[model samples]
Target: MSTVAQPDLAVLSSPWTLGPLHLSNRVVMGSMHTGLEVRDDGGAAMAAFYRERAAGGVACIVTGGIAVSDEARGGPDFAVFGADGADERFRVAVDAVHDEGGTVLAQLFHAGRYALVQGVTDRHGRPQRAVAPSALPWAAARGVVPEELTGDEVRSTIEDFAAAARSARDIGFDGVEIMASEGYLVNQFQSPLTNHREDEWGGTPERRRRFAVEVVRAVRAAVPDLAVTIRLSGADLMPGSTTDDEVDALVRDLLPLGLDGVSVGIGWHESRTPTVQASVPHGAWVSYAERIARVVRTSDHPDVRVIASNRMTDLRDGETVLRDGLVDAVALARPFLADPDIVARSLGGRFDLVNTCIGCNQACLDRSIVGAPVSCLVNPRAARELAFPARPTRRALRVDVVGGGPAGLAAAVDAARRGHTVTLWEADASLGGQFALAAAIPGKEDYAATVRAAVAELADRGATVHLGRRAAVADLAGSDAVLLALGVVPRPLDVPGADLPHVVSYEQALREGVPAGTVAIVGGGGIGVDTAAFLVESPDEVVRAAEFAERWDVDVARDVLGDVPQRLPAADRVTRPGPEVTVLRRAGKIGQGIGITSRWVAVGRLRDAGVHLVAGVRAYLRIEPGTLWILDEAGVERAVPADHVVVCAGQERAPGAEETGPDGLVANLRAAGVPVAVVGGARDASGVDAVRATSEALEAVRRLAP
Candidate 1:
């Protein structure tokens, strides 16, 4: 196997030209909807978000897809370019990026069928119907059929694109990128499955390509001096959708029409392919970009560069692809959310200190999908960056943080950084509490990265960490403040036979191997789902290799001959034929806390592993011998044969931990004349995760010292 070296910082940070615009680095911040824009002001929160990334050393920043026309918008929160007072609202954002030596581009978008089906409203608060080349119902759009655009409507939409580009240019944006990918209006017209129109705007490849080509031509003409780029789906991945050959032809036809560059966005909203999930191998889509780059390389307009996107997490992977001539620039969206200064840190050779994105979409894309501001699970201060500045404490004081989990680690680090003498104690031999168990889950080793980062941060910030040492409340008597981040313990099952030898907690199942047989997992929450994934063995390497080759349409023989690594490491890959697992949930849904962005992937994996999911079980009658009795929602009793039962019902607060209210731990501690704070799962039985733990810890430390 060929070993890829560490990224050459000099090469990565070198200045590169994208058509007429010069970038200080080859890194482009991929545009992602943050849901941070102030509806009244153009992009107040959006500007702050981008400015932070620009200051962190990103070469160019692409603003989230700005709605070009009110009729084509997703929601009131979406940035509008041609709307009233849009220029004034957008000027501040453009200036903010420019001030930080980063070129900003406005991404013009029309969500089309998605917007209508999503019930997206216009400025007047009326539901905006989606328009497309043909009246097709996208599965994601539920049952809503998009209104097929008349030829006149199509032409006007093209004008809307041009006008939006002009507005962006007028607002002092460096460029404008037309959103032609991801099942949007433009992509709808380009796809054979979506655009079944027999008119000039569809049918033949040239006709289907007309809408995109026209939009690019019109936008380029409207904003002659501004750089124009189109975000294209290298392959839509949808059934009977636009193929690579079609995309190549489309690119060839569009490049000659004054296109400056193309940003490759892989897959559509409805595609079966996994594009940007954590389970996806790093640089999985680099091959798609390479194909597009090769096409651009031989095109009549070779000046147009290919920007590789979709799961480009780290500079090492980005550098490898760039070195291999796959892409001219690597575009990252989530990584910047995890570490805004990722580029600067890489350039300075502080790679270890760089908090890499774990691709857990829980906070970032998941929140955005629900119309909330995008944040990071690992980095608490993502969209709310300004809110978390670690200012000096009012005075130096001794601080004791109980538990060395994410919460304790964050509090200790932040408190120490604020000039407090901080000590963190964990009862276990290591820092990570539940996170360690989380890391042990198959395909979830990235959680370990969060623990590693926290540990490093604690050490760097001069926090004393004590492992295998249990600190009592009495031990914190002399401390000026105490933070109890004592994590959660498994909630025991209340039914009969819960104490059987085969009945184990989810933690035990994750930490230790379960007996190989029919295993039943109780609770379909995140832990239950994860435990099921952990217990089930993945398909063997030979099976996985065949599946991969089939998924990507690669030749297995050629792949083997090329020395491609087909077998996954024992630590990372899943195994099959290991255990017959069934997940039982009292609730109607499974993986409730799992984010929508990743829940499907987890469920899909479970399905592929042949794990049975049974929901709406009203009662667990009992467990006897090798059988478990459960009552269904309809009051029917069913006997499920199980060799072992794993309980993942949920977590409860640790013993003696108080609530988060005024009369909680802090109040009681203060009543005893000792300053105190509380954070993590110890503070609340519900609403506990890494993001919450970390953010609450930072806030608690700041409030304690303030």
Candidate 2:
């Protein structure tokens, strides 16, 4: 709050006005799935979730992918409903937001064959039975595609959208956004791969685009004055499907239909198609936005300002594209989940202190799919913020942050925001510890951005920082609480030949460089794989490495890693099959440590990389020179030529973690002598080395409290 804001450049300043509704910025909160509604009767926390965005200063808040008709219902209460009772109830929710001086709209949709059967019963709740273009399903399985919409079904479907739009308008929605993107029924029809029908509804470009066109036309006709927007993809980004040229033509045809704006997006690129999602960096698809926005900018369509939306979590990232004129507005889905009041803070000049969305797909996608309200892992108060705001303290407590990483940084931000005087001690000049390394991975750079934003927020929020200082237990003096986030140390194996010069550790490769050649890697844990991944091209290149790193981030969801990692795949890397890799796993299964899905993927890559796996082994033989001799399960010594051996057992406790934070959350807080907390890998450790160290650190800070 020290400096004045540089104009809240979010969706509020979108620059275009929709009738009496001029958004405060260009940060539109695009519609997403949050199974918050209790029933199709239109009840529960769904309204509050949407209202939270409005209260948070979103320029325009759109509904989740609601089912427009019974047949279109995917699962449970998708916001879309046709019953008069549902619209009336939705109106009450709209009034709550309107009363707050905010604008809102609903996105009307039909799941097509993608519709779910819902609950354990998997009732095809509302079945739109039928093949899309070629019976190729849109999303992950829920079984039994409804019979393709008959000619009768087609006419009824068009009416469904219009009727839904009319229903939305009557329910007091400020406007409506046609769901023509994200591989829904509309995108299915727009895509030639899915829509092979020739009867006026398919085959040719125009024919294929007919369904979306009709929806837009119908919605526009229904809401002549209400701002009617279209969510359209620039290109499908799929193989054997729509290309950029096809995208150009699609826009050319849709432009004359009188849309107030377009929410330009990318890939619902079928499972087989390369799509941009969680693993992808923020704004990776901006080109798609710019391309489509420009193509539609000709003539009166210029008024159809293009709104670029995605998991644009960081504000600066959003501003970068907006400043370039490539997009008029930026849509933030996950970030809002992390910090609902982000708008107020950004406007108030605390942009650096903004709690960011780490692009963890756990809350947004996973929870929704499993039938729960969407939320974030890091930010506990996502959708339910109204009920929780860091509670006021009865008295002041001093706080000390032992390490600077995601959890540590998060703790510092909240403690400071909660009015605690905090000091964070980082051993390295760089604040982030192992976290920086995690983010340094090629496809995971976005996590680095999250850390960067978190660090910036820490500085802005007034947490005093100590760089180049590693605190020992003795250092935990004179504080009220200590958060020992001083992360984990790599566990090194003690075998006779483990210390050769050619053998490198994953941490070293990340911090240094891998010599380019036929380097044989020796361990296959996440770190070992990280080392291999850094030096080699493909998992298959170090064929057995997939076995080592397969379990990384395994706790994210469904006994699997984060879902974001699944959706956010990077461009495949091609590796020459020379660096004959060797992995030694005690667990015979090459993919055991990793998730079923990720393991298959990684093992396949490792196979492609030609990595040789030697599991159920225990010893390494060799002190010098050229070869790595391994003891196989069969008690045979198999030797593989090695230029490098990277040891990647997971991280061990810091030099001392146990004797640290002993008593509990409070005792530990008092030990640090400052308000602090540990997170990530550090939080997982509990022993004399880790826990004792944690207790001592906490006591150090507790002494500082008044």
Candidate 3:
């Protein structure tokens, strides 16, 4: 609808037909488990969540893993096909999407050995153990050993998929997608690593794929009028697992099974390769989809479209892939969570208005992994659309928000969006305080895109922004309400030689270039780990997919089906020339404060980069001209070579900050009889958490709005 030229992205807005189902565009809202399906609201909350995204302009919505049976449930949060009140719950969601002129697909799901949790119950309130092709322990630490499904049970599970497809059609779903990817029960049967059976279900590669083939054939017959798709694992990215040739053959087999589409996904949950994390290059797995598309195009049924997904957040990339005719559609799951209107906005040539997902996974994936409701770090209202409606307030109040960092920007934009008169002030010349610094880190380029989008949104909402201007009481005289989002200053290190000229704060080191020499980082938190990565990695290597493939040992060409080596060939780290970096922590694990989903991946990258991680430091002995002295946990002293010392110890409240008194602005504003709300680092500077900061800002402004 936008007048601006969007020739490059025209294919994204074009129509496409997947057999019986036709879509208005090539963008699909990929399935993501929001942990909201089990809400007691009879699916009202989940319905609202889907309806909002449906209205935002996705061609179709894929419901998160709907269990075909009680034993198929991945967790307690999954929606079971035959549970009590299940029809009503599913109908509500289906009607909600249909009301918004969007089609919905039910993803039939079954967790095999991956079901490691215990409290999951059947509709009859009986506990069910996990079932797989073979009895395998998913992880030794958790000790979750699943029972092997008998041959009859495997056939019954195939029937379960057909029954679920029938239920989906009765519930008004336009289509059904069998979940055969991500190492689920169907995927488990396709791999020799998990499917050790000598029966019809496993043994040879052809036999190993029989379970998936049968499930598809049954589901297709069960829903002949509806679009039947299969989510296939293009490359498991696991060692000693299913090869690429077997997967290609499986695709060829499914092409004759009357499937309407194939949505390609990569990597098992247990694979050592990074797939969805921030470090992963955007559209890194598109090549796998392209390969499958090649197989599908040359097959008997060319109408079976292929959907590419995995770190795909940009529509331009989607357009390129679609234009090139490699893949028919592109699926983006988290980008929709960041901004539900991504499709509409991009189609309107207002791509700058899109709130890009920085792929932090802090609020979304991290929470979902533990069965918490999923939300976005940049947009917290995602999945809670009903709770935080954007309706206008009774009266528009003049709201003044101080600081232009993540929290301040979020407060200003959200306040304006709710029809309030808003003004924001940033002491720095530009916005994005901590976010700007983070943008400088490798693989975090999207953080800068987020800032640009936020700034544009503020302008679109007609909020006044003053940069390089510090807000004072005089500046806020005309404000009806005040929000203090004054973000943090670096918590100064207190050890000896901390004030040396060679020493720099993490902020300074990120904003400016570090001297080329051995650098010692005095903290092992997220910032410290990021700082180490930034100091050692070249900027060019971050965006280059080939470089990433080489470093992570991904076979981009897919000749061997993108199989990962059992153990990574040793990184030529010792001889690589750059600034030698060392990260030190007083106690606890490295990357302790990082989110669960990203901590291991980030820490592994640091180790791969040859960053020396020193933990359990007894004390910082001293710092000299070219060395940092430290006492070990064993009561021994050691000197670490350091031409430059960067301190990333954490954050603290702004200088001279106080919650009460004439000297404090908060107390002064309260004494002046103006409503005051404090948020972000100004409220609590325990650490620099963008998630907490933005959430606080949104909650405070919404509560304080007139």
Candidate 4:
């Protein structure tokens, strides 16, 4: 295998013209429903969110899907195109993006069968009804069959799209994108499985494609001066849905109807495929863009560009895909959430200083799926950039942060950036606490990037770091304020014979290597699942890497395999006969507190690796020399023989000999006349991960900076 040279940064930052619209660069902020609307004032919060991204150097921004009419609305939080006073309301947001030298495009959408499934109400407090091409129920819609559209109703819906496009152009948008993807209303008309009508609208493939084609034609005719684009699902990835070939054919037909560009979106809301998750390798869906680009290049409209979306988080990967001629532009949604200045940092060649997205969907998509405001786990100021703007401190004061984990590191960096003298103390030789152990897991190496970014930011901001130094109360005597981010200590299992020689804590098992043979993990939470993945050897990492390389036309054996020894020792290292692992949990379900988007990916990998899962355990009987005993949910005693027993029950607050208040060590420190703040897993008895800890620490120290 041969290696491909890295793409030139200049070419990536160069300007490109798509139809009549001219962009500053090739980067596009892909459309995503952030759930940041103000509800009363035509999405004031959503407008401010877009303004921040525009100020950060994104060339073009595609606003989240806006409903064409009240019936087409997904929820009250979504912006409505033809609502009363909507044009005046949205013009402010468009002008804000324009002020920053960026172009904004509105995505006109209709949710169809998947609208307001969770009983979401409108501004009038009335439940929204879903309309579809057929009377089929989407699994995500909770068994609510939509009312099939009549021929007259279909024509009116197409007219509604035309009216929406005209309104977008009137409101000062640079362009309008028809939302014809993601199993929505437009996509339902394109897929044969969803559009089961016997009428002219849905019979053959060509007939099924009529609705989307008509929408494009009508929208283009209604707003002739504005650029008209359509977002298409390159492949639905669902059974009985449109195939790749059909999507290619559909794009070919729609291009002649007047589409300035095509943005390829992979999968649908109902598909079981992993579209955008941490487990999925980057550039996994570039081929979808390649297929659409091929069709566009072959057609008369050769200038029609293709925007490649779906997990193109890194700029290097985006540039590689562009240099390889897969797509004309790269569209990223979550990467901007992680670092709004991703484009600016890349252009400045300060890649090391950039906070890269780790592809963890916890705070972003998972929050949106449950109707919560969307934010980033890595960058907490994503949606609240304007609400919680950073300010410099009035005076420099000495600040001491005890613990070099995520929380402490964040507080120290923030303090130093705010013009304060900051010192961070870590008892261990390293910076990351539990984060280091998490990175050692088979497929979770990306977690290390968070620690690396935090450490680099701390150094760049001139925060003094003290490793292998335990801070006593006397050490913080001269500090104006002290922050206790001292993370958590593992809790020991209280079962009889837990102190046997073969039994070890989850930390020791990962740090000191697990013993060879069968292993039993006594908990099924995030730690236990990760430990099970660690002990049992699996091909998920290798397969995902190879698959990603193949799709992007890169040399895995050279670009990936050559760095295996350094990039991933867990995959290459071998022990005497891999262990057979079993995960036991007291609850009926495993992986509690795991994100809804990536939990299934972890569980699926564990299952494919032959790891056994025993849930709903009533009691832990005992642990013998090389065996452990437990009672099943049915009260039946089960003796499980194992060479090693690993307990991952959870974490507890760090022990302190001093008298503490309800708030623990923080209150105790304040009583001692030290201005103090507490954060991280140590503050919560149940424990918090890096995301929560970092967010809490940043917020707490910001208040103390003044």
Candidate 5:
């Protein structure tokens, strides 16, 4: 009943306003399905889930696909309405958001033919079919005809929208957005391939636009100041679907229907519409938004605002789109997940160190698909905010951390932030270790960005970072305690030809580009073949492309491979350092540990390029400077040409020794001679946990406290 004051500074600085409400910033939190929504009965998560994102300072927080009617929900985990009753859970949500000085919007959706019912007496379940215009299945399905909707059913659907809008308003929501993109029910009706009816709702573009137009008008008429948002898909990428022209026309119609605003996005990562790969630059959708703004300006439409999102993790990208007049506001999803304080940081214009979202979609999307709670990959403290808020710490003892790699850095930063005097020692001059190399490869730059962010977080937390410091047991002598994060060293190939001068490890090959001529790789693991491909695609860009393509052709038999070879991301993003490499192999599968998407792309290119792949060959001897002998799996030795041999075998760690560390050795000094606890890969098979600067370290520190 009382008014809550918004952040005074943010509101005054931002130029955008809707009704009497003023936006402190143009950033809006886009909706994502948090698999975390699953409740005990396999329903949505407790009310606490939505409350945190609001608490985390989202200007406007949207829900994971909440359905207009029960049937539209994909699962019970989706936010669903009960018959004619208010959602009491929203009271807590509204208060939590208001406490944080933010607004909340409910996204009203209908999964349409996509919905399935599994609860309570088998329910209305997919309806033995659906009410699609024609029969068009989406992303995970080939085209199929949906059950046609009767006129009465259509009328009920419209009424359902009205009821849902009223429910949202009654529940203290600032607004509701009609999801009209990404191959959902509404998009299906609006798409030609999916809609084949001759009725008033499906004949021409105008008829097809009728359903959405009616829904918007009904909702707007129901709640005049309810902030009605209709999210539009710029390019659905399906045949007979809406195009830019159709989009322009649809906007002309939908605008006059009393819409509060339109939020625009692209593609169907999970749906049936075509999706562009992550290779597409960040904020690639801005051009489309700019085009939408242009159309609005030239049209005789109402004074409506536009909200656009997609790859908006970078604040500059958000600022650029806003400044360029592409859209009225910028919406983001992964950025806020990566760093909840991004808005506060960006207001400071410290964009470079803002903990960027690399569009990996792994932690954000992949985890949600498997029904896990959504969070950032690098920031483990998110999604568990209620249980573990990022609190200011109490001062503790000084501690030393060895090895500034991923694991070490993660532990160090967390400890330092928890009020420990942390000093991190790296053998190399720079922080990123093997991760740096992995990130340098094509399709791996995201990992590199992750490492950079980690280093920044460590330094910000007051960790003393010592580069070029090859730490040993002596480094921890002066510390209250030591966290030995010694990483693995490269393995040696004791094979006969390893001693030859041309022999190199993949790491060595990276710094000094692989020399011209033939190459032979000894390992068949993930790193081995990946590095080999990069070596073959090295420095001589044009010639390397031809040779790399030609090698695969020659190996697969030139005509068998034909004229087309796959493209390398390296060719587009950066120039490689070496020459056109021809590779010879011992025996192994090429794609060992690459992700489903990365492996498929990488292997397809090499196989298409005709690179000769010989498996099960045993290396015999380096007989000549430019030649080597290899015994076939059949026991006959044959000669192969090799200008260089690279070993790809993995490394070793003696956790065996670390566990049963020699009496009174470095690890035993803690807890009046209680040995260190090491979990994860660092722990022994005994299940002892690793020492954390907070929990584990603080626990140990408590024992010694006065």
Candidate 6:
């Protein structure tokens, strides 16, 4: 394998100092909740999770939200300061990172109204009511209203932040970061939409900013020797919330409060705009950080570092921003989850070996939103680092991984990395399988990058990949173990005229180009919605950062001093019009199987693109030369006119098994006394997704690997 050309990352590689803390580079591992803190192993799991990333090459690691008090805790999994063994957990994690020559900062957090979950308890083991600046019901929390914090309670919360910071210093943490962004307790007080208080905590802009100001003052005074930073919302994105000027003012006030750094966070949790989802372009939120950086640069504390964060998965992009001198550093959260060694790989010019975060949010953010243990879709060993240790095998064996999809690639790499000789087979001319088709969708270019990374990793691990070869039972019989990741075949449309030339499979439409005329997409699942989004855009418009910003009306080109525009001005371009696309579903929601975090963004993109969506279809009746017929839920037959009928209904197991049905391949291999493991869509296509496929592949290798 040839070494890839390296981009100049001089600025990103430069050492920097933040107050009392010194970092090796400008890259920081931003905080993310992995639900490993509450584990019974006294933070062993969480320590391993941090140590792996720290060793991978992050200059500093920001620990996930550590609640200051019982009322501030987001949920039961949130590590609280006074909780039993909390200091021990902090000490373990800090010591582990320090052992790897890495610095870690504890992020003091308060969930505010977001902690409406039932499990949150107080010191006396009684259910604690979620507290906020005012007694308002969060829109997403149904009708449950948070109790307004009394003046005394609010002051106590300030003391809580101070105590947490003091505890972090005692635990050997390098620093402490106050989480004031993302609609948390401090952010809630800053926004009028949530803070209806008439006291000094609200009423006016300066008063509204008082809560955060006092918290900063308290925390800084408590740990004067520690490197203290605050994560501030650059733009809340919520209507009737803190204006950009007000947020800037808050930053100005906080800078004078003896802060070391400011990490800019974008959007509120309830904001309609997409912040971290895949559809959001890489570096879309950097401008907000730039805005804050400008303020910090002009302030008395010009030495304070400002970190650009959100939607920054690529280090090259981070280097670009750093080179431009817009911000002092770049903090990436989910990308580290996807590839712990993202910095090392990119620095070595082995970008192809870096598993890029596709921004799918399937496993990480989606699970974190529901308090589930957060892992990665591409790398399932993220939080399970200790369990899936990559120790070289004492006795390496021959391993055959059939099908070059994500599952097969993962298995091949895992086996090869374990010192086993691995051989991978793919019937297609190239690898990627369905991911290649997915990459054709404008916003999903990273899906192709994922495949490239997997392929590169396989080669780097000394695994042999045979393209355009279907390994039969005979071909695999001699292997010590055969891992079947044969993937899935598109479930055929079983209606009349289904074989018509105008009726194309979803794969065909994605792999090849759809017709220029109208398109009626059958099945409003993830694939169907993706196809609709693809067909509704011009071929040349690949939905990169600039184009996405334009389409979403984010006024990125506005003058820095001007009040940030809520929407961008229209720009006319001469280009071919897209096809008229309509997505149909029999039942359930469109993009049904997509992760909760990304489904809305996908559906929103379709709607914004003028794609028609039809649900409650009783049945797909038939396909004509230029139309598709469907039975509506109203018991009426509907004719959807279209030049192309794309079927994305779903998929079934690949026809790898012969006489013994779907299990024939496994049965045959077992009959020949060969070890066999079936995974991915080959094992079961029903509700099969990338997350499940890669996760199953790891489990199979864990069991099969010696």
- The number of residue pairs in model 6 that clash at the backbone is 0
The residue pairs found clashing in candidate 3 are none
How much RMSD separates candidate 4 from the native structure? 3.5
Residues 1-706 of candidate 3: C-alpha lDDT, one tens digit per residue: 0022336678888899977777999999999998777777887888999988999999888989988888887778777876867778889989999999999999999987877458666777788788899998776216778989998899899999999999999989999999999899999999999999998888899999999999999999998999989898889998999898999999999888898899999998888888888888777777789889999898888878999888878787677667777689999999999999999998888889999999999999888777778888899788888788867888999999988888888888888988999999888999998899898887787898888998999999899999998887778877898888888999888988988999999999888868777889998999999888787765642234555788777755332122333323222232223338889999888898988878898888878777899999899888888899999879899998898999988899874236676668787777778788888888888866888899888888888884
Q: TM-score of model 2 relative to the true fold?
A: 0.76
TM-score of 3: 0.95
The TM-score measured for candidate 4 stands at 0.92
lDDT of 2 by residue, 1-706 (tens): 0111345554344456754468767777777776554344355355566666677777678777656776666565564464435665677668867877788878887767666653422244343343444566545646655466666777778888988888877778898888878677888887777787878888788888777788788878887878888888766656666667877787777778877788887766244322333333345556667777788776556767787766466665566667656568777777777777777677666665566665545555656755666666555545554344445555767677778755566566666766788888888888666658766554444456556666776676677888898775556666667777767767676766777787766777667665544455555654444444444443221122222224221111111112333342243433335345666566546645442223444444455556666667766666345676777778888776666666665566564345445434335444555454444456564321221332333333333332
**Candidate 4 residue-wise lDDT, 160-193, digit = tens:** 9999998898889999999999889999988888
Residue 485 Cα positional deviation in candidate 4, in Å, after optimal superposition: 1.9
Residues 533-573 of candidate 1: C-alpha lDDT, one tens digit per residue: 77773423334434554655633222112333555545543
Q: Estimate each model's TM-score.
A: 0.91, 0.76, 0.95, 0.92, 0.76, 0.95
lDDT of each: 0.78, 0.62, 0.84, 0.78, 0.60, 0.84
lDDT (Cα, 0-100) at 210 in candidate 5 = 85
Candidate 6, residues 1-706, lDDT tens digits: the string is: 0112335788899999999888889999999998887777888888999998988989899999999988788888887876878889778988999999999999999999988557557767899778999988776665668999999999999999999999999989999999999999999999999999999899999999999999999999999999999999899988789999999999999998999999999888988888888777667777888888999899888888999888777788777778767689999999999999998888777778899888998898899878888899888888998889867998889899998888888888888878998999999999988888888876787889889988888888888888998887788889988889999988989999998898889888777776567788899999998888676653332224455667655644222112323333222322113337788998899899999888988898787767788999998888888888889889899899788888898999887844375447887898899888889898889987888899999889878876
Candidate 1's TM-score reads 0.91
For every candidate structure, what is the RMSD over all alpha carbons to the true structure, in angstroms? 3.4, 8.6, 4.3, 3.5, 8.6, 3.9
Q: What pairs collide in candidate 4? A: none
| Per-residue lDDT of 50 in model 3 | 93
List the pairs of residues colliding in candidate 1. Answer: 537-575, 537-576, 538-574, 538-575, 538-576
Q: What number of clashing residue pairs does each candidate have, in the order they appear?
A: 5, 103, 0, 0, 17, 0
lDDT of 5 by residue, 1-706 (tens): 0012222334323756654356667778788776444343222232454555565545777766777775566545466655322265555566667677778788888877665432311134433334455655554433533567777777788888888888888878888888888777777778786778898889888888888888888888877777888888876755556777988888888876777678887754443321322323345456566666777777676468787777556555555555545468878877666666667666665544566565545555655644456665555544655545445456577766666655566567666666778888787878766667666554345556657766776767777889987655555566765665555545777766578789888888765656666766666555765676666444323233244334422111121122334533334333322333334445555554443334454555455545555566666555346666677667787766667777666665423225335532345445344233332223331221121212332333223221
Residue 698 shift from truth in candidate 1, angstroms = 3.8
Off by over 4 Å in 6: 1-6, 538-544, 557-579, 657-663
